[model samples]
Target: MVTSIILINAERTKINEVAEKLQEIAGISEVYSVSGKYDLVAIIRVKTNDDLADLVTNKMLAIDGIAKTETMLAFQAYSRHDLEAMFAVGM
Candidate 1:
């Protein structure tokens, strides 16, 4: 599985509407309205790299209110819980 976080800059008046539309897309797992240089932040999970590309290029970019996007791909995770589990007493 491939996961990506997309930061979306949308038209000010259209933020909520755009966020709602993004939530309906297949690869988008989460969407939130945020305050900063960007208006919304979304989490997307797809089957492969091509799927991620399609979502960003074809789907997300096609949305009406979206102006621009910055995508970040997660390469590895090192959460505290994961580290503890990995070192647990088990063979």
Candidate 2:
């Protein structure tokens, strides 16, 4: 699986709408409304890099309220809960 984090800057008045739209997208697993440099954070999970590119460029960027975005690719996942669920204890 390919995991990516997209930091989005949406029109100040449309943060909620933008987040809602992002959450509805197929490849985007989660959307968070956060405070700081960026207004919303979107978590994307896809099968390949090409799928990610298509999702970001073709789908995500086409949203009306989205002004700008910065996408980050993740090399590895490090979650104790997830690892345990996948591999079981002492495996």
Candidate 3:
């Protein structure tokens, strides 16, 4: 599976709304409200790059109040917990 970490910059007042919207997207596995340079983080897991692209471009970007996003494609799973989690994606 392809995994991506999408860091989001949302309009301050609309962060919660943006995060709620992100959680409704199909390929996204998790959405987190975080503190730092980025206000939210979305974890996307899909079977192919095309699926990842569709989720990011079509669904995620269309959400209101998402000011900006930076998507990072993960290359390898280093942590044991993450490796185990990868097997559970499609189940």
Candidate 4:
């Protein structure tokens, strides 16, 4: 799976509406309301890079209240639980 983190700048008054609409899009796994330079963050999961591109460019960007977005493609993923499990098996 390919995962991407998308930082979204949305119309302040329409954040909830934007988030709701985003949730309806395919390949979008999660949406979060956050404070900072961006208004919302979205997690996108897809089968291939082409699908990711289509989701962000064709679908996400076309949403009504999205003002701007910064998309970061994930290179690797690590978690505390995964690390602990690996060490436990060795011991």
**Candidate topping TM-score:** 2
Candidate order by decreasing TM-score: 2, 3, 4, 1
Model 1 pairs whose backbones collide: none
Give model 4's clash tally: 0
Tell how far residue 44 is off in model 2, in angstroms: 0.5
Per-candidate Cα lDDT values, in order, are: 0.90, 0.92, 0.91, 0.92
Q: Model 2 TM-score?
A: 0.90
TM-score of candidate 4 versus the correct structure, residues matched by position = 0.84
- TM-scores of the models, in the given order? 0.83, 0.90, 0.87, 0.84
| Cα-lDDT of candidate 3 | 0.91
Best by lDDT: 2
Deviation from native of the Cα of residue 50 in model 2, angstroms: 0.6
Q: Which stretches of candidate 1 lie over 4 Å from their true place?
A: 79-91
Query: What is the per-residue lDDT of model 4 for residues 32-87, given as tens digits with 9 covering 90 to 100?
Result: 99998999999998999999999988998788999999999988879685489779
After the best TM-score superposition of candidate 1, give how far the Cα of residue 5 lies from its true spot, in angstroms.
Answer: 0.6
- RMSD to true structure for each model, in Å: 4.0, 2.3, 2.8, 4.0
**Measured by TM-score, how close is model 3 to the native structure?**
0.87
Give lDDT tens digits, candidate 1, residues 8-56: 9998899999999999999898999888899999988899999999999
Task: After the best TM-score superposition of candidate 3, give how far the Cα of residue 33 lies from its true spot, in angstroms.
Answer: 0.9
